[model samples]
Target: MPVYEFRCQACQRKSSFFVRSIGGSLSPACTACGSREMSRVISGFAYHKSMATIHEESGGPDRPGSDYYKDPRNIGRWTEKKFKDLGMEMPSQIQEMIQSAREGEMPESVKDLQPNLTDV
Candidate 1:
């Protein structure tokens, strides 16, 4: 089996499709918008790392968009983008987090959590 990446023009979301055969009769639809019009996209590979390196190639903390995530608004956008990229439904917990950030408030549970001694 092989996985293929596709971008939907309508929703501007990307998703992966696992296929048993390439030549067989099969069509892919956008998981988010249910649009059949999609284009193949080149997928990037990811790897696990023990530590992040400050380099352009590795996309570390020093990367251009890294600072964008620090903003609460951008954090919500990033979360939506991530969910769209993975073709996964945004979970309720994540939705609440984004909503709270957009509203300039932290979730009550996160705000009320007391730091453990071990964390310090």
Candidate 2:
């Protein structure tokens, strides 16, 4: 499916329409104003990253930097990876907590888990 955005002539608001096929017809009306006069908008584009590229960007599990934990992308990454590495399914409760953390609300119990170290 492809998404086509349009600018409404009457309300000047933007509306997007999802087409099932590239060659299919899409008559997009302004969802806000219900106007049929829409001008096709040239949407900005983006590309996806492969697993290798993503792993490389995060500095991988074995070599995470001091600031790696600060990255929002790594929010619940370690817990998920640890479960996968152990060949275990993450519990639904833990999965919910991780998802919530990723969505921006940190679980009170899991906050401020900075590592503690001593000269050994």
Candidate 3:
């Protein structure tokens, strides 16, 4: 389940709701004025820590898009152009594993561990 923030236009009230995905946004009628003219706010939920926060908590590898990647010592010997020249197709699972690692969640399997070898 995911929590979403919605704002009521009629009463100018904001509320958060834990909703099941019903294939669309959960913009309900205003609880105060009963107006269907509510507009969903794009932000304001703090239910979970962000990826950076999670990385800080785990004390894991450096963040992917940080200044660390800009260092010459951190640069990969084979660049993206080299991989493209090799005609390599990045596996979807490897992509997902890299994403997970970036979020500080390392999967405990041989295949999942491969991405950890690369500089996140």
Candidate 4:
């Protein structure tokens, strides 16, 4: 089961519910205001660990005491593998985007939105 977050428009309260399927519709009622007008928000998952944490927890990979850094190709490989696992075709644009990121060149689409990291 997956958890989904929802915000009540009437009372402005947020709640989370475990949903069996992503396609299922949720009740719009607000727990506080009893209003049937609520909006769904992106929910966070608590049960899973991130890739970096998983790597660290596994004793830094096969070589003991060696720092375990993710392979630069891992992202592209994972992206391709995920599509294969889902029985879906990988889009060429996504492949290109991963390639560009690996090459350290920001994609033209998001170039203008780059943040100024020097600014605190």
Candidate number achieving the greatest lDDT relative to the actual structure = 2
Q: Name every residue pair that clashes in candidate 1.
A: none
Cα lDDT tens digits for candidate 2, 10-36: 999988787688877788889999999
104, model 4: CA deviation in Å?
29
Global fold similarity of model 4 (TM-score): 0.36
List lDDT for all candidates, in order: 0.62, 0.69, 0.54, 0.58
How far does residue 86 in candidate 3 sit from its true spot (Å)?
A: 56
The regions of model 3 sitting more than 4 angstroms off are 22-27, 46-120
Residue-level lDDT tens digits of model 4 in 22-94: 7876675666778777788865542443455565664422332222223433335545665788899978887
Clashing pairs in 2: none
Residue 90 lDDT (model 2): 83
Worst 10 residues of 1 by lDDT: 45-54
Over 4 Å off in model 4, which ranges?
45-120
lDDT of 1 by residue, 44-76 (tens): 521122223324433422233445444555445
Prediction-by-prediction clash tally: 0, 0, 0, 0
Which of candidates 3 and 4 reaches a greater lDDT?
4
Q: Write the per-residue lDDT of candidate 3 for residues 1-120, one digit (tens) a residue.
A: 565666887789876666678566665776677777767676734435355465564442333434443333333322333456679875666555555555555466423333344544
Give per-model CA RMSD. Answer: 16.5, 13.5, 13.0, 16.2
The candidate with the higher TM-score, 1 or 2, is 2
Instruction: Tell me how far the alpha carbon of residue 93 in candidate 1 is from the true structure, in angstroms, after superposition.
Output: 55
